[model samples]
Target: MNTSLLPTRHWLLAAFLLLATPALWSCNSQTTLQKQLSEHQDQLKQIDDDTIQSYLRRNNLLTKATKTNSGLYVVNLVDGAGAAVKTGNQVRMKYVGRFLSNGAHPASTGYPASYGDPRYPQGAIFDNSADNRTVCGCAVFTAGTGLTAGFGEGLLLSRVGDRKLLLVPSRLAYGPNGTTGIPTDAALMFDIEILEIL
Candidate 1:
């Protein structure tokens, strides 16, 4: 039997049958979902951009504003409290960083918490877990230097025993893309107490 012997009407009917298959319907749904997903992502990007701008605009360290140069704001806190430090500088600090959107504090507690023991559960936030770290001790920013631009600027405004709150905009805190736990184009607030400068 020759396959070419198929009738034109039969071929037309076969084509129609394929065109109206359930798979085509599934494709339509997937296409619609993809379109919606694209639109949602675009909206999210716009929102993130807007949020960054709004935060930057509203940020005015006027009370502690010292200088502004190269897109960096230098704030000098009163009483030499939580001030800025330069890179490679050894400093002792008790810092607490919190997300503006949520009160989740992200700090490496430098200590370990006892797990599974009810008597003396970890006293501090930092537990013995491999992930938990304590940032309370003195840290020397060596080699390439350390801390974010905003944090570096913050040190300059601090004295050995000063304690001040640093309100860092995203541009000053983490820039356009922030670190983990911090959203993209986000504004960060830091409450730093300068224990001692070594």
Candidate 2:
């Protein structure tokens, strides 16, 4: 009720507001980032869908390739002689990964300069087996784990000795924030040859 106490109360309220400002600002900033991420994801999906459709049309693969439920497009180049790969199986394979922006050329010989691997000089090849010399090693991953959703799903659809070309959307690969060597919101194409299933 005293006039003197009014100034003290005002100062206390001002200090409280000042201290709370940063927390409020952080929440607002986080919300903004999340919204941006969601919007970016949508943009990436549209870009990927358009790119895949274009590639399919240009390559005359629209009839041969089958679209999976998750939106992956799988075109089998060779039928496997061995059993089909299943979830939880260990797979050894060779792969060449490239950005969809580089076009749909799947041949091993002529990759764009921008997409060439320094080690290969001609083109990049990713392998996970120890015996292969042309590539470091064959790609080995447990089906349904330790790999991108697209790649894993693609593997499950293949069998040993099967060669497949996969069109992977960003969400199934690295999402809106891609990892090193892959750009953010970039769609990917993977040429995979299954070598073995352990």
Candidate 3:
């Protein structure tokens, strides 16, 4: 009941509340974001599954395409006669990447210095090797460098001269946070040809 202390007490209370506001807001924002992400992930998974199934049914590839344990769908278009690639082996490959939703290519011409091929036709091809004169040069990378879970796994399953199609879910591709040109939660399709393994 001290009149002098009342103003000081009120100021302290206001300071405490102001200091705690950001923390409270941050907690709520993080929780909401997490929930949204979880829902988005679930939705993307279902959409990817449906797209893959529909693609298989439409193309009569239901029996030809094999589903991996990690949810990737692989269809071997051509079985290679060369040696199979394994982890740590450097690989040279040509690929065309497309989004499963609308079958639009994400890789555009004139971005990466190595890319930008006139043969691809702008907005038609995503990524391709220069050998094909499509989009870019042949992709050279180690077998298991974790560049992309889906692509890496698919590559390991293929051999030199092998051509395969990979259906990659968002989780294995870019997840909810897709890169530029690739939409968030978008599924992807990759047509890859293994040129060499060194």
- Whose lDDT is greatest here? 3
Q: How would you encode candidate 1's per-residue C-alpha lDDT over 1-198 as one tens digit per residue?
A: 776867976989999999888788999999999998666445433443333334335665455544345333333343664444655657766665644322111221211110122322211221111233545543433212466766667766566666655545445666435566554434344556666656
RMSD of each: 12.1, 6.5, 7.7
- Per-residue error for 59 in candidate 3, Å, reads 0.7
Q: Write one digit per residue (lDDT tens) for candidate 3, span 1-198.
A: 569999899999999999999999999999999998777566556666776777778889889999999999999999999989999999988888876653222232321111222333323545566656535467787998966799888988989989999988768887656776665555678889998886
Score each candidate by Cα lDDT.
0.48, 0.73, 0.75
- Measured with C-alpha atoms, the lDDT of residue 40 in candidate 3 is 59
Return the TM-score for each candidate structure: 0.43, 0.75, 0.76
lDDT, candidate 2, 53-160, per-residue tens: 777798898898998888899998898899899989988888877666422222223222133234332223332244456464675779988888898899999999
Q: What lDDT does model 2 reach?
A: 0.73
RMSD of 2: 6.5
User: Which window of ten consecutive residues has the lowest lDDT sum in model 1?
Assistant: 108-117
Residue 12, candidate 3: Cα error in Å is 2.0
